[model samples]
Target: MQIIVVGIGGVGGYFGGRLALTDHRVEFVARGTHGKAIRENGLEVKSIDGDFRAFPYKVHETLDTIDAPDLVLVCTKSWQLEEVAQQLAGRIKSNTLVLPLQNGVESVEKLTGHLDPGQVLGGLCKVISKIDGPGIIDHFAFHPQVIFGEVNGERTERAIALEGVFRSAGIDVILSDDIQLAVWRKFLFICMISGMGAITRQEIGVMRADEHIRALMETSGKEILELAKHKGVGLTEKDLENAFRAIDAQKYHSTASVQRDLMAGRPSELHDFNGYVVREAEKYGVEVPVNAFIYYCLRPMEAKSRAHE
Candidate 1:
């Protein structure tokens, strides 16, 4: 299959590198130093499961250089989704399957707003990874896996075929029956810890160990649950329980990409994570005081980062 991976950052670099290891024709879209490094030295993944390198068949900064792809993985930060979607609209064919592996629940909506809805799929991934260098990705923790399915939850032929492709590359993948719920389940955990982690400038273990911080985290999670329920996402109490369990299972020093970005003064997913929840809560008449507070407190820093960018 002709595959295109947009934004070859942590998630993209690792997953796209895995796919590139296969015989499939995988193309990468990246920019600046990272793009140049990948083009020259190949993409490298330092994974706990095992280290591997994938020299993509092609690499480009824009979609114009490539042919229409059968699959496109949107791995940019949540805020960049719209821009990437606009770029993909002209490059993808009718049968292209676009899977967004970013955080938050609005990726599918963002893509469909710009591209054909039929080409979009609900997707999320589980992995603690980041770019260790220009062309190197460090997969430090977790069993890396991709979960994806049609937005409406049908097991289509394309979904099945894609699953086979991932498995053939020796990557773990799940073909979710309820991808929306799966996305929300991941969102609930990420939103609960990420904003607070940024605010506290601490890791998951530190936040979970403190009683006051733990209380704040619980309240933040409840707010997300309320918002998800308002949106009719079918996130249940069991899901909420499982979210906390996932948080507890994380490595002591584990910090979300959003938290790390904020600490490093880089543009972050604050608007996509806490800000999205606050906006949606206001629209649905739900109260999210904790989320609102975190988002407001971090707005100044976020603005400063973006201003410099």
Candidate 2:
């Protein structure tokens, strides 16, 4: 399969580099120093599993050099969706399948505005990773899973074909039947962990260890579940329990990526995570105090980020 990874950052870089190293025809789309490094020195991934470098692959800043790929992985940050849509509008063929490995629900719709709905798929990537430097992806986790499904919720040939490609490349892929619910449940988990961790500047281990923070996490999760119910997303009691159970099982060692980004003074998915909950809460006439508080508190940090810039 000819794959084009549209963002060579943490999630994209690590997965794309791994596929390329496995001798798949992977093209990485990057920019600035990272793009230059991949073009010159190759793409490198440093992970707990081990480290590997892939030098025999293509890297470019744009799609101008490549033809329409069979599959396009939209791995860019949620904020970059608009520009990515515009770029992909001309690059992707009608048959091209675009899988958005973005955080929020809005990405699929946003990209659908630019492409056919049949061509866009929902994808969620579970990994603790980030870019350490140019051409280098720093991953801290061993278990990396990519969950995805067709938008229409059927077992389509495109979905299966893509799954086959990913599986051949040695990836843990789950073809979900209820991807929307899966997305929301994942969002609930992220909102709880990211909001609390960003607000308190604490890791999951620290947060769970503290009784106060643990309660906050649980409350924030409940708020999300409530909001999901209000929105008629069809979330189940099992969904709520399963999410909490996963958190409990993790022993709180699993931290939010947003928390790590905020601590490092990097850009976070704050708006998409906590801010999304607050916005949706207002729409449903639901009060999400914990999420609202986290949104307001970390908002000022955006200014801090600008000042540094």
Candidate 3:
């Protein structure tokens, strides 16, 4: 398959690097110093699973220079999704698959608004990783995995084919029958901790250890659960329990990418994570006061970061 990994950050770098090891043709879309470094010295992945490198590989800064791909793995930040999707408008074939490995649940909705709905897939990933340096990705925690499927829940041939390819690359992948539910389950966990982490400027361990913070986190999660219920997503109480368990299972020093981005004053997924919840809650007439408080508290910083960007 001719694959285009659009954004060689942690998720894309690790998974795309593994896919490049296969016989399929793989190209990466990166920008600025990172793209320059990858084109100059190749892409490097420092992973807990194993270390590997993909040199002499194709790297492009824009879609204009690349061919229409059979598969496009979008790893851009949530706020960048619409812009990226617009760029991909005429850059993919009719049957091309676009899977967004972002944290939020609205990726498919956002993409469909820009491109053909048939081209977009519901997807999310589990991993704690980052760009340690230009052209270098660090997978620091979690057993990396991806879950994706058709929006309509059909077990199509394309989904099966992608699953086979991912498996062949030694990737832990789940082809879900209900991809939206999977996305929300992950969202419930991420939304619960990410906003709180950003507000507190602390790691998961620190937040979980504080009674006040823990209570706030639980309330934020329940707010999300209420919103999900209104949206008709199949998120359950058991899913919320599992989400908390997942948070507890993380490394003490573990922090979400959103929190780190906010601390560094970089643009983050704040609008998509907590901000999205707040907006949806208002739309559905659901009360999400905790989520609203966290989002409002961080809105100024988020706006400042985006302004500079």
Candidate 4:
């Protein structure tokens, strides 16, 4: 299989490294220092699953350098998805599958706006990881899993084939029948965690342990659930329970990539998480005070960081 991973950050580097382990041709698309490092030293992944060095078939900074791929993983941050999709629009073949391992629920919509709708898949991943440094991905927590499916819930041959490829690389992959719920469930977890972690500047273990912060997290989650309901996304109380379960299971020092970025004064996915929820809540006439408070409180830092970028 000819695969293109568009962003060699945490999600891309680790999973793309796993895919590169196969005999298939997995080309990476990274930029700046990270791209240069990979071209010079190959991609090293420090994973709880296992550590390995992956030399992809090639490392190209831009998609135009590459031809059509059997699969394209848009592993960029939530904010970069639309730009990545636009770049991919011209390169992908008719049969190419474009799967976004992004954090938010709007990825399929964003990709479909730029690429072939049939080619876009609704997807989300479970992994606590980030770039430890240039060319290095540290998968320090959680058992990584990739859950994806066709946007309309069809059991397509291509989806099955792609699932097989992940399984071949020992990734815990799933072909979901209801990908919207899956995406929403994952969003519910990450949005609450990222917002709480960013606002409080605390780790998941700490926040989950503190009664007041735990209440904040729960209220924020409830707001998101109401917003999801207003938007016609099926998110249940059990899904909320699962989200809290994940928080409980996280490593003591685990913090989301968005939280880390906000803390470090770097550009982050604030708009993709709480900001998105707040906007959508306004649109749908749903009250999301907790999410709005989180977004408004942290948005100034986000703007400053982006201005620096």
Per-candidate RMSD vs. true structure?
0.9, 2.0, 0.9, 1.0
Local accuracy of candidate 2 as per-residue lDDT tens digits, 138-227: 887647889999877999888988898888767789998878887887787677778688888866778777898888888888888888
Backbone clashes in model 4, listed as residue pairs: none
**Candidate 3 lDDT score at position 189:** 96
Off by over 4 Å in 1: none
The parts of candidate 4 lying over 4 Å away from their true place are none
lDDT of each: 0.92, 0.81, 0.92, 0.90
TM-score of each model, paired residue for residue: 0.98, 0.92, 0.98, 0.98
Estimate, for each residue in 1-309, the C-alpha lDDT of model 1 and write its tens digit: 989999898899999999999999999998889999999999989999989889999999787787889999989999999998887778879999999999889999999999999999999999889999999999999999999999898999989999999998888999999999999899999999999999999999999999999998889888888888889988877887898899999999999998999899999999999999999999999999999999999999999999999
Which pairs of residues collide in model 1?
none
Off by over 4 Å in 2: 63-65, 249-254, 303-309
* lDDT against true structure, model 4: 0.90
Q: Estimate the overall C-alpha local distance difference test score of candidate 3.
A: 0.92
lDDT of 1: 0.92
What is candidate 4's lDDT per residue for 1-309, written digit by digit as tens?
Answer: 999998998889889999999998999999899999999999999987789999999999888898989999889988888888888887889999999999888898888888889888889888878898999999988889999998899998888999999999889999999999999998899988998898888888999999999988898898888888888888878888999998898888888888899889999999989999988988989888899999999999999999998
Specify the poorest-scoring 10-residue window by lDDT in model 1: 61-70
Question: Which clashing pairs does model 3 show?
Answer: none
**Stretches > 4 Å off in candidate 3:** none
